[model samples]
Target: MSDSLAEHVHYLGLANRSDLYRSAISDCIAPDDTVADLGCGVGVLGIFCLEVGASHVWGIDSSDAIYLAQETVRKAGLDKHYTCIASSTFRAELAEPVDALICDHIGYFGIDYGIIDMVRDAAKRMLKPGGAIMPDKLVLQIAGVSSDACHEKAAAWSDDIVPKVFHWIDEQARNTKYPHEFAPGELCSAPVELGQITLNADTPEYFSFEAEIEITSSGRFDGLAGWFKSHLGNDVWMTNSPLDPNGIKRSQAFFPIARPFDVQRGDRISVTIRARPEGNFLAWDITPRGGPTQKQSNWATTILAEADRATLDGPLRLNDNAQASQYILSLVDGQRTAAQIEETVMRDRPDLMPSQQGTRNLVRDILKRCAVS
Candidate 1:
């Protein structure tokens, strides 16, 4: 099977994940309620909404998996109650606001994949007053761990090996966060709650939190382990914590330090984590009470890049691509269907769009930028 199909298969097989969402959505939805499933993978959440008596469920996704989702809904005999839209939640518009908006965009650390910004936008424009936002809260926790396996992957670039992992990759590998499953004894320090995110609230562009973690066992402080408990609502929740037997086995986020340092029982380590400016961590500082500190940032890249400041800084002129796009968009004057517009564009602008598939892709991509219902 293809990777995309395999992914959806995996999603469908995640009984732990599906159960929580199913229960939570069932608790909140009524027979007359309309629901929106953003990033509706396999349409399972939307189907759960329908099964629980939601009136009309809209499942929006940007991938071609939308076709698979449509088929899934039809196969379940829920086509009449469901509508699958092949568009990004950022671009997809709903006709008449939904009574609730649900999404499964919570990343490993609970707040990655730009879900916060997307949910913030949806809450404002898509949901009705007091509309439910499932998994409204993400409770973050962190602990120090010792794992040769986890450290080796991040430190591999520094090894004197033949294939030559670039020296620059050392910075990126160590700085970037990873997902790991910690053995019961892997943790050197007792896990502590770091912070949380309420999905619908106005959150800061950058969120930072510091903690003093005390070691409970003797081991090398290889890195920090982070996980979250997502509150899906109505007493239903799921977590990726290593110790939770009932939680989803999705693992936890791990950040490898530059060097492995030794720590003993009762030793305190100071840690400060900065997350956001977009989903992932920007920087993390780990310092042993009386030893050296390891500080890393994802922003520090090896490549020298130029800033983009064209239309933002001054007068704008549309290029051929933008011009063709704008002219095709003009065809969507509230009377023509997307298919009608595509045929018109392919016929009228043979010079601009030579191939049929290319013309269709272009027209549909341009349509992704509009918020038409």
Candidate 2:
């Protein structure tokens, strides 16, 4: 198995998240029912369903780790009730309709990692009529946060310790999105519901929402914090909200501002969010009431400056290897094997790739990038 997949399997083997999912699965599943476990890493969820008296479980994942999941089921003596498929739910064909579908595709703040599209597609195609999905409803909440700790971590690069390197790091921090942990006392305003997402056949692939939050405490506002609450069946649910006593332990979404602003009680902050299910891109705009608004988008951050563009558009300089990289990428057709590609690269550009071993490593790296499965 690949290192990345192994890391994921190790993470899923941890007790905290697995315990929560096991409890929810036991509550939602029924005897003599077929279950579809989407993105089933190591087949834990499907095995949990089988232990709860599920008739059969289909464990599907896109990674090669499905082989490990099959082995896990066999070792547990549950292979007769579980089938592991090493294919994405988008391309895999189900032999029979499932009575319920369960997936933990949620990311930080509950929108990233393309969960919405995956759940929507499975609900429409793989589930039987009236079939239920775990965490059927999701509500995203946003609040204005006053966190000196977070501000220090995000703006540390602005210090004059290392001028050139820190300046670039400061720019990157301002232009990037991050997952953060917020102390309850750091919240300057009560969380407001930003949006609600329902997983079903009628849900749209694109959505936009706006909300106004009233600040209840006086403090410095550096950015916004986002978390989600999910409604699993039988009144079992999980949330990461700061106010919830029984919420899951997970990071909240943090969108850093270019600069911090001081504010007083009764101040109002307006926020707008746009989400695209296709690429799981979320754009946010936050404005202090009567102040200038700032916009940040996960889809279009790190823009190139005009000066940099002009430099690239100028005459080709010596020792520039961008063309060689492009040529290597161009040869990544579906028909050519990695060995053939390595031989062609060695024969064509011996100066770029000197040794056979180096060419083989280069070909392997390029093929990994170009691989779709």
Best by lDDT: 1
Model 2 misplacement above 4 A: 1-16, 165-169, 302-354, 362-373
Tell me the whole-model lDDT of each prediction, alpha carbons only: 0.82, 0.80
The global Cα lDDT (0 to 1) of model 1 is: 0.82
Off by over 4 Å in 1: 162-165, 277-281, 301-373
Cα deviation in Å at residue 309, candidate 2? 9.9
Worst 10 residues of 2 by lDDT: 316-325
Tell me the tens digit of each residue's lDDT in model 1 across 1-373: 2766887887667648888888888788878799988888678888888888899999998876788889988988889989999888988898889998888877777876667877888888899988888878888888998888888877877777825646767877787777788886888889999888898788888889898899999978898998889899879988988888887777678888887888899999999988882575457899999888889777654344343423467776877888987898788888887778878887888566667787778888887666264
Model 1: lowest-lDDT 10 consecutive positions: 302-311
Candidates in order: C-alpha RMSD to true structure: 4.1, 5.1
